[model samples]
Target: MHISHTSEDDNLKRLLSFSAIAIKSSCGEFDIYGEKDTDVRGKELVFERTRYVYNDALEYFEDNFLSQITSLGISLIPESDEDATI
Candidate 1:
């Protein structure tokens, strides 16, 4: 049996929400929707460090991925920011 489209949509939505939360949390943003805001008080410094690490890692991966593809001689058409949102 195959997964249903509804389930796929729900999973995608949840993943996107999780990514948003991770980005915010890494940047020391208050989690108004959860108890982490109070529970992690005084830990924003650590989260601030995490933000740099995450950005560095993301940049590394993007650069590595692009280099791998370009080295294979496959030309990539650049997409506009809106088209690349997902």
Candidate 2:
């Protein structure tokens, strides 16, 4: 079936995308990291410390995971400035 989303629906959809990123990252499907240091760094990838966060992690999701979906010519319109903040 075909369905269309209004502006309100679009905003909600984008906001809800955070949960998807969280779940996939937590499950080791989408890695929120780039490089890793060991021994001198205790050999681990930690969040916001040994690893990255916020924009870095968000960028990882967009480039690795989200890009694949959105690249299929899907109409994933950005809701608004408010949606961009999240």
Candidate 3:
């Protein structure tokens, strides 16, 4: 089935873009801690790895989840103030 892009799709893309920006800004860096190796005495050696959280998140959204969502041709149009009941 061929799905045509509409104004709703554009709106959804804008929303997604804005959300990604927010996520990137808030999650700038993260501390990743894990066990790196063990000594001869069986003592575990721990390490702290600093990574850019936003880059990882952006990669995931663009390379993985976003592709899937686009393939499914799903779009969302948020309700405006005029449509709000309360």
Give the worst 10-residue stretch by lDDT in candidate 2: 37-46
Better of 1 and 3 by lDDT: 1
lDDT of 3 by residue, 5-85 (tens): 674666544554555444333332112222322111111100100111223444444344444333222212124632674
Residue-by-residue lDDT tens digits, candidate 2, 1-86: 12365746554445445544444344333323433222112112222221223334544643454443333212223347437778
Top candidate, metric lDDT: 1
TM-score of 3: 0.27
TM-score of each: 0.27, 0.24, 0.27
Best first by TM-score, ranked? 1, 3, 2
Give a tens-digit lDDT track for model 1, residues 5-43.
675666545544554455444333444344543324323
Show where candidate 2 strays beyond 4 Å.
1-5, 30-86
Off by over 4 Å in 1: 1-7, 28-86
How does each model score on lDDT?
0.40, 0.36, 0.30
lDDT for residue 18 in candidate 1, whole number 0-100 = 56
lDDT of 3 at 80: 61
- Name the candidate, 2 or 3, with the larger lDDT value: 2
